[model samples]
Target: MAIKITGFYQLPHQTMPELVDFDEVFDTSFMRKYTRFRTFEKFLQGSRLKIENQRDFEALPEEKMDAWVRKATKFSSWQEMLDTATDKYVMHKNM
Candidate 1:
C-alpha cells in the first residue's frame, strides 16, 4: 500500500529499482509506465508520450517532469515517493 505523506519532502529513502531510459520508457510499451523509473530521461519519455509530438525529449518541460515520472512509477507521485521512500543506506531496515 502507498502511504500518504503530509510534509517533509524527505521520502522514506527508497531506491529506484526499475530505472530505464527514455527510449524504453515510451517505446510503445505501457509496461514501463507501471515500473519505477527515475531520472529526467524516463520522465521525458512519459511526457513525450502524452504530447505525441516532435518536441525534443531532452528539452521537455521541466515543471511537469516530476508529475510525468510519478505517473510512470508505482508511487502516486514524486511527493509520495519522497514522503514514503525507505532509506537505502540501511539495507537491514527492510530485513
Candidate 2:
C-alpha cells in the first residue's frame, strides 16, 4: 500500500515554514491518541475561524490565529502546540 503524509514545522528562530513527511500510521495513531481533532484540518476548523485551506489559514493574522489556538486547544501558543506535538510524536516513536 502507498501512503502519503505531510505536516509543517517551524523552529523558534526560523522565518520559513518547513514541510515534513510523517509515517501515515504513526501520524494517524498520534492524532487519535493526543488530540481532540482527527486531523489537522479538523483542528483548524475547531478554531471556528472559517479556515477552508492552508492559504485561508495562513492569511489569518498571527495574533488572531494564536488567540484562536489558545482558546481551542490547551496550548497557550502555536509554538507550544507544535512543541508538544513533536515531543509526543518522538516519544511514541521510541516506544
Candidate 3:
C-alpha cells in the first residue's frame, strides 16, 4: 500500500519526463488544455527539471535541443535549418 501511494503521488511528475522541448507541453492540449503548461511551469519553479539556470539550459547542444523541439512542434522546414535553429536556441535561449 505504501508503494502504491508513493507511485500515485509521482504519477503526474512522471507523465512526460522526457520532455526536452517546451512545445511538447502543447501536445496534450486535447486532453487538458494549458494543464500541461501549468504543470511544466510548476516544475520549472520548483527546479525539478534543471531549468533554474539560463546558462545551464544554454549548455545543451543545439542539435540535441532541436531534435526534441522538432518532435514537439509542427513546424515545416528543412531539417538542416531546423537543426541549426535548435542549436541557436540552446545557446541563446530563443524559440
Candidate 4:
C-alpha cells in the first residue's frame, strides 16, 4: 500500500547478508540499549516500530517485527542495530 504510493518498493529491497563476528562480542541484554537512549519512547519516535509495552514488543508477529525493524533503524535488522549500539556504548564508555 504505502510502497505503491512511494513508488520506491525497491527502497527496502536489500538482501540482508548474514551478520557474524560482532554477534559474539555484543551484549544485547533486554533494554540495555534503550536505557542508554535518552528514553525508550524517544527511540520509538525516531523509528516506525510501535508497540504498547514490552509484552507488545515481544508478542509482535515475526514478519511484522522484521518489517518494523527494517523501517525503524539504519541497520537491515535488529541484530545489526544491537551490535552497532553495543560498539557505540563501549566506545563512549571508554572515552
Candidate 5:
C-alpha cells in the first residue's frame, strides 16, 4: 500500500496554510515512536514550549528546539530523525 504524508501549518496572518516538510517525510508510526506524538502540533504540545501557533513556532530558538528534539527522541537532530526513520521503514518494509 502507498501512503501520502502531508501536513500544513497556517500563520494567523496568512490566508493560506503552508506545507510542513518534515511531516511529509515519513509515516505516522515512526513519527509516533520517535516523537511520542501523532502530529507536529501534538509534538509541539508535548515539548511544553508554549508554541500555540505558527508565530510562536517560528519564534522558537533553533538551537533550543534542536536540543529538545535530540533529548526527546535520542537523535542528533530532526534531519537525523527523519533520515533514520525513513531508513528503518524501508528496511522493515523490505523484510
Candidate 6:
C-alpha cells in the first residue's frame, strides 16, 4: 500500500522569511502617504502594515501602492489576502 500526505501541514520554521527592519530601510516620505503620519520617525515605530489606512494607500502612485500590497501580502501574517482573486470578492464574503 502507498501512503499519501495531504490536508493541512505546519511548515518548518526555517522556511519562513526573516522580519524586515522597517526603521533601516522603509522610505518615510513614501510611507507617510499611507497615513496622517504625525512624524516620519514616529510612524516607523508605530505603524503596522496590516493596519494601514486604505484610502491613504490608494492616494499613492500605482508603483507605490503595488509595493505596499506586496509588502503587506508577502510579509504580514495576513498573507492569505494575497491568495484571493479580488478586493470585491473579499468584501462580498465579509458582508
Point to the candidate with the largest TM-score: 2
Order of candidate numbers by TM-score, starting with the best: 2, 5, 4, 3, 1, 6
Model 6 earns a TM-score of 0.23
Which run of 10 residues does model 3 get worst, by summed lDDT?
Answer: 1-10
lDDT of 5 by residue, 1-95 (tens): 11223446453555897674544445577667676677655666678776766666667787778887887776788668755865664465456
Every model: Cα RMSD to truth = 11.6, 6.2, 15.8, 13.5, 9.7, 18.0
Of candidates 4 and 3, the better by lDDT: 4
Q: Which 10-residue window of candidate 1 scores lowest in summed lDDT?
A: 1-10
Question: lDDT value for candidate 1?
Answer: 0.40
TM-score of each: 0.29, 0.56, 0.29, 0.43, 0.53, 0.23
Residues 25-65, candidate 3: write the lDDT tens digits. Answer: 22234213322333333423433334444564556465554
Number of backbone-clashing residue pairs for each candidate, in the order shown? 6, 0, 1, 0, 0, 0
Provide the overall lDDT of each model, using Cα atoms, as 2-decimal numbers: 0.40, 0.62, 0.36, 0.44, 0.62, 0.35
Candidate 2 lDDT over residue span 1-95, tens digit each? 12234567554446986676544323655556655767665666577776665556567787887797677666687767666777666565457
Number of the predicted model whose lDDT against the real structure is largest: 5
List runs of model 3 lying over 4 Å from the truth. 1-50, 76-95
lDDT of 1 by residue, 1-95 (tens): 11111212222454444332323223333334345544333444445545433343334464565666566667666445433332221232345
Write down the TM-score for model 1: 0.29
Better of 1 and 5 by TM-score: 5
Ordered list by lDDT, greatest first: 5, 2, 4, 1, 3, 6
- List candidate 2 stretches off by more than 4 Å: 1-18, 21-35, 90-95
For model 4, residues 14-65, the per-residue Cα lDDT tens digits are 3553332232223344235433424334444445555555455556576765
Local lDDT at 17 for model 4: 35
**In candidate 3, residue 66 scores what lDDT?**
52
lDDT for 35 in candidate 2 is 59
